[model samples]
Target: MPVYLSRTANFLLTEEQLKGLLKRYDINGDGRLSKKELQVAFRGLGLNFSGFRARRALQHADADNDGFITDEEMKELITYAAKWGFTVN
Candidate 1:
């Protein structure tokens, strides 16, 4: 579900695809997303400031304050990602 975008093209990802894409970055196979994992995921999406973005993502989506993005919190994360767009450019 990793999408490549041109500078002039805008691609919007479906929630399911976005979710799957993010889940694929769970390096520890923990069924959750840690800050580091999220940094990698954001980098994969061709985003800058991935570390900062990851921290913000956790802040916005880590509902339980557990420092991880559980399945239950994925919707907010997906929304956040979508809002920012997955465009490579």
Candidate 2:
């Protein structure tokens, strides 16, 4: 499940990382995370989350809108997170 995100070769996440993020944010267990779902999930995990912020992050990653973010999407998301100073782990 690890995905390679190439952007100056600085941002990449392994499959375990992806699974951790999914398990952290996939509150609904629907295999995907909506804006609200992400918020709830993160918050439940003791993360200080904003729905709008998480939405933007999810939108950046969920390219196919297939509801769930694929491994590729997760890679892109890591890149974005690294670029924007969001938590990448």
Candidate 3:
């Protein structure tokens, strides 16, 4: 017999969770995080970084150049952020 947990218990909003997870960086709440948004988030965390430098740092992940980090781009951004030198944490 297949015994499954309740929907609430099994439900894992991966996408929504990703959005909410990065909410701090998604200041506008447009479901995406922009360079400016990232800068703001980092600033809030006491990470001293310049506006121009911030955008450039995120450029590595912004392959499309749309000026925003999409859900697919989030992975790269996260990895890049951890290794990027622009951010002074």
Candidate 1: residue pairs that collide = none
Q: For residues 2-86, could you state the per-residue lDDT of candidate 2 as single tens digits?
A: 4443422446677566457556666656655667765665455344445655777787888887655655676665565555433
Clashing pairs in 3: none
Assess each prediction's global lDDT (C-alpha) against the native.
0.80, 0.58, 0.58
Model 2 lDDT on a 0 to 1 scale = 0.58
Q: How many collisions between residues are there in candidate 1?
A: 0
Rank candidates by TM-score, best first: 1, 3, 2
Q: How big is the RMSD of model 2? A: 6.6
Give the deviation of candidate 3 from the true structure as CA RMSD. 10.6
Off by over 4 Å in 3: 1-21, 50-53, 84-89
Model 3 Cα displacement at 41 (Å)?
Answer: 0.9
Per-residue lDDT of candidate 1, residues 1-89 (tens digit): 34433322566555666788889999999999999999998888778889999999999999999999999999888666655654321
